[model samples]
Target: MDILLNVVNYILGFGAAVFVPLIMFVLGLCVKMKPGDAFIAALTLGIAFTGMNTITSFMTGAIQPAAEGLADKTGLALTTVDTGWPAMSAIAWAWPFGVLCFPLLIVINIILLVTNKTNTLNVDLWNVWNLLFTAVLINYACEEAGMGTTVAMVLAFVGAGLMAALGIKIGDMWAPSIEKITGIPGVTVPHSMTFTAVLMFPFELILEKIPAIQNNNVDAKWLRDHFGIFGENSVMGLIIGIVLGAIAYGELQAALTLGIQAATAMVLFPMVSKLFMQALSPISDAVGDWMKAKFQDGRELYIGLDWPIVAGSNELWVLTILLIPVELIFAVVLAPIGNTVLPFAGIINTCCAVPALLLTGGNLIKMLILGIIATPVYLMVGSSFAGYCTRLAQTWSPDSLAGMGENPSITWSTMECPDFRWVLVNGLSGHVVAIVLLIVWLALFVLLYKHMAKRNVEIKKELGR
Candidate 1:
């Protein structure tokens, strides 16, 4: 176990940009891909990841200062600090079981695949921290309850494995539509946010039943046709930036700078994602061919990836920008409802809203309504978990949330945030209600899969499957 852990650390030490591509190159070679094609694919994947990091950095640099200014200007004495996702990740990696997470998850995936239980070959390893985060939360809970480290570790592995299995089911459900958009075969995003689309499935159906809403639906196609060039995501991003900037900083220069930044982020995200897809093409083909030949059947397998390839959808960007103000307003006016953490507009817009829109068929109206529903969930969860997060950080890595604020703790508006919080409240803390809710959440996923499967023929046609 020590040797395996050491090997995992050494490989992951290079970071995702290098490590992921290196692993893919090795896997490609093992799969009998041409040496030149495998090397090019791996190199291109690295380049794509590097470009993505650059764009994300620029977006963070532009939006974060303004967001901080906005929070300060509000003068709210918020007890809970918003330390952001990086802090949360730091806490995850610091936990003792963190060293074991990578090999455990990889082993789980391989087991599932060999047993024919899941066709999703999840390669989005960089986000494995999420699974680790879940594990640590459970581990902390189990330890507090007098469970032995071995038992805690086993439970942690169970939690992480369950999430991966859930991701496979989700990737299978959403892959066809994603393929249509990116023109890349056999790939889907299976992150936490995309999984939340399951929760929205029933609501979407209810909304569609109402002709008043359905007939008057203002979707992406409507925007493209009515607004012409102004409806384009780049311009919409600029407009959103100008609005956000003006709100964050009451100066023309500041507003213009922010507007350009938003526009650049909106444009660059899709562009960088396309580079990723291009790099993935050869490997995707090789895997698909191998699967069909080995299985002796034409199974529609998918690679579970991160949420970049489908970023091009105009509905996603537009709805995300529109929800920024809504999230902020909820944070301020709804403080009574535990809205301590001010919404980080940039992260929420990119991470939460886009996945919601994509899973709901890019229906802008549905997406907006989902955002409205999700706001309170974020606020209450973030606020409630702030204390636990603070304790965990102080106990595990005292400096993890340092420099955010005094006694700073972190929370997230990302799709995984609520689930993480709920696990803490229910799974670890022995809150029966949370456990029940989780059971219901899984039940909802089952219902959603069945519901979608009933319309399989229609969905496949729509997705060009």
Candidate 2:
């Protein structure tokens, strides 16, 4: 296959800060480690992914030119042009079934971990390009319904392998509260934007059965113990970068240089998530002691990873700077009532709501009411998949539409995957209204995964788990 697309484009051209710490120093010398602790745990996970890409490029260079100067001073005549997620991952790697969807999702996650269904060994292979951006837009909407392109690449690779087997059952329901806050037990985070927090677990159990939001018990360690060090988290990201640089640069020296680059991205995103949990705790303890000397049924394994190791909390940077002006004023007053396409680009405030604010465990009022009702349903499902993502970026990456400028006629990406419910279930899959909206969203995720697995066994018997 053209030498596996020239060795996956020469290891994605040495990018992810040199191929994710040279694939975690060759997965810590394929679990045998001790080559000077896998070269100091792959040079401290490539210096914690170059200090979380230099504090996410100083918080997207002070919030993408103040969100393209509030979408060019709010003259909202929107015509698709949001263009973020790296030009929709260069039109999902210029489709033709996106370069064998990265070795068919690493051979369907190693045949769902050698057929024991799954134990989630996903190994965040470069975020499998968000599952090959919804399997190259559902293999170009099942090759515009005539199918055959080898049955539209096996029906968009079994609908992106059933969304990575429902993101490994949402990383086995948040791997025991992320191994009780990073002691790093099994591990999780099967990603696709933290599996859209299973569409907000039945609206956070109907806002925790509203006895006034169940006594609101505002979290983030009670705003760092009732505002002690100016309620630190890098001083509330220097007061939300001096109120988003005084509402987009009404300068007090560019709002204190975007409040010292949002207080150095809230104090270096938890010191680059404690150097990516000290380089994934000795390769997650050498893959849980090589799955206990190669699995003798004590089973338990997880790993998966990415969602910036539980997105540096402090209520996910105060509900990502109060939902960046409520996702740019709800994409300018609900993009003419949800017909979609307004965001000029702020990458849905903190890269598509930091995987539903670490699946709402950092409950800044339930991630600010699920980012004010899912940032206008991700700007009307990224404006109903912005005309088939601007006709799959002018038919397979016209040099990513001449590098996003040649004057935007159309483009889209408020958080990736040729979006808006993957263009309403790959433009209504083979029809019958996308199999009755995929059996009513799989019977509302089997009654919200049996009411969040009986509210996670009554929150693990009220924490005496």
Candidate 3:
């Protein structure tokens, strides 16, 4: 047991950027790439991920202070401190059974791939804890319902398997959207974050029927053409930063500095995303060809990836950045309904924003609307999950939340990416309604898959493929 924990810790200690490229390198070798070629591809892939991580960190570091400042300006004290996703992740790894989720998830992924239930390989190793969190939560739920530890453990694994499959399907479904938006091919982002689109998908359908919202498409290109230099994401980012800076801190020099920084980050994203595409193209093709031969059915294989693959969208950043303060205000307004967790740590909220960007076809106005609509769900999930999250923290890292200023609970909006926080809460409450909700959720996915299949066909036609 100690050995297993040590090994898991060591591997994860390398972090997502280095770890993902290693997986790609091994996958490259398995698919029969020459070692030298695989090495080059792997290194390039790692570099791309590093760039994404660096920029993400840059944005978060730059933005969080203003976000926290906004929270301070609110002058309201919420009971639960939003420790963010890292706290949840740390708690998952600290759990003894956390390491066991890897094999369980892998076995499920293999069954899914072999049975043609899903094409995604679920190789985004770093985010496995997302499912692990569900497993741990379910384990507690079962135990709370008077099931013993052994039974709770079994049910937890069962829940994780279900979620793993759901996540894979979500990733497979979104591959076409990712390709359509980024023009990148043969790779799918299967992170739990994209699962939030499952909820956004319904709203998307409703908007589809309303021709006014559906027909009027406003994307980055549209902004660039209409607004000219100022419409460009870089310039808009500059303006937004100045506004946010002024809102948070009334200093002109600080606002200007933030404007320049935001502009630079916005412009650099496309360049790094291009490097990501360059690195991924060869590995993706190799895997697709290899799978076609191996399957004997001419089916293409898409390399499952992390969220950053799609995070390059200017639309995603725009929605996420703009919503940071708005979300905090919503939390304050919604406090009467048990929203105890303040929006402090996970303020950017790209997990939900990125998927909405794809689903709405990057209509800035629509994405913004969906974001506002979705904020309550996030608050509810975080507030509801706080007790469980706090228990986990108390069991594992008791001192971690001491400085956060209240009955601290983790607010990991990433896990709520329509990732079934409601379902988790229902199941944990030992209600039969959980079963109905689960069935409904899966049924929705069935319909979503069909929708995606048709959409993929249309996209292929458009691409002249």
Candidate 4:
């Protein structure tokens, strides 16, 4: 029965991805839009959903293996007694320190959202995942080749860290050059030093929890808060700090438990929230844009609530309080029946929050209603198509090594393999969806172009000598 339900839910999820876009098209047409306009909107929503899913899946694939290798080397068990997902060991070890750092992360994400700037710091989430994965792969290779764990960890850390640092720095420096070449002014890289430091918090926790490195007295929490240490502190000092902290903490098991929970919350909650936002974004944007056009008399109103603000808001607090019982009910009543269903509840919670935020905008009730109707339809179509494509790519190339064979040197395979696949899948999906939707959007753009051409012909006819 549980398996049947899960299969049903997965089917429903895929359906929702397809359904959401079709609904968006119908809503657009109801507003007297040309077929082209409606189609474009639907297509754009589809593309966005697909792109995000693809990137997310690719990152997950790359990171999970590395995380597993790191766990094995550190003597952490790989299986969760409950779900059996790779225990997110690094995150698990850092759980205790996370308590001190979680609030700060919320603040940083909120600031970024409110400022409306794309932060480079946000990219570090991906970078850390990638680097950690790379470290794991390298460590695995070392062990397979008969190197000691100590040597493997050291080499992996140094190699991955140097690569990460170089990639980040080069990307930052070249961003302006690319923008200039494209003639776009005022574009800056996202994620300040502060944001990057905060992003590294989970990784720091992982480092702290490793038993072998327990002698290093590293204050993971303190380093997370201090940019100078991360930026200029000597490598020896960092290692020493970790060794000392582990020794001071004493109970490796307890420290590991705390670290896992903290890192889990840090990664899982933010990711869940992002997924909610992605699911909600098209609807929110459509509704907000419609309301401003129909009701706002040239005054700008913030209709969408950014995720960070939502996480920090009093409303969220109240919602969390309300949800506690609901979560408990699911755990107690539902988990006995099946545990996988619980994660879906989290997804549902996020989905519910989107419509709530849209409705709360007050002045845009009609638009909100339209958005509520349209969101699910878009999500159903978009997510399914994206997930399918991403999974296909993963099946084709399960590892970076397979994707980039015969390259003994590192030679940018990290970026090259994943980047090429991501661009190809995302770009193709976006363009194809856009074209298909254009046909349904009332062909307003096409009609306008034809009308202009006719007018030019008439002018030529009138001016003939």
Q: How accurate is candidate 3 locally (lDDT)?
A: 0.80
How close is every model to the real structure, measured as TM-score?
Answer: 0.90, 0.34, 0.95, 0.25
The whole-model lDDT of each prediction reads: 0.71, 0.68, 0.80, 0.33
Which regions of candidate 3 deviate over 4 angstroms? 402-408
Q: Using lDDT as the measure, which candidate wins? A: 3
Show model 1 residue runs off by greater than 4 Å.
1-3, 143-154, 212-221, 401-408, 413-417, 420-425, 462-464
- Residue 101, model 1: lDDT of 66
Clashing pairs counted in every model: 0, 1, 2, 53
Clashing pairs in 3: 196-417, 196-418
Quality of model 2 by C-alpha lDDT:
0.68
What tens-digit string does per-residue lDDT give for candidate 3 at 60-179? 788888877777888978777666677668877888788888887889889988898887887797888987788878887788888898988888887788778777877788787888
Relative to the unseen true structure, what is the Cα RMSD of model 4? Answer: 25.5
lDDT for residue 91 in candidate 2, whole number 0-100: 71
lDDT minimum window of 10 residues, candidate 3? 410-419
Please provide, for model 2 over 95-190, each residue's C-alpha lDDT reduced to its tens digit, 9 standing for 90 to 100.
655667677777777887788777777666766776767766676677777777888777777777777777766666666666555555666777
> Where does the lowest 10-residue lDDT sum fall in candidate 4?
408-417
lDDT of 1 by residue, 178-226 (tens): 7766778777777765665655667778887988767775765677689
What lDDT does candidate 3 reach at residue 281?
81
Better of 1 and 4 by TM-score: 1
Question: Which pairs of residues clash in candidate 1, taking residues 3 or more apart in a chain or in different chains?
Answer: none
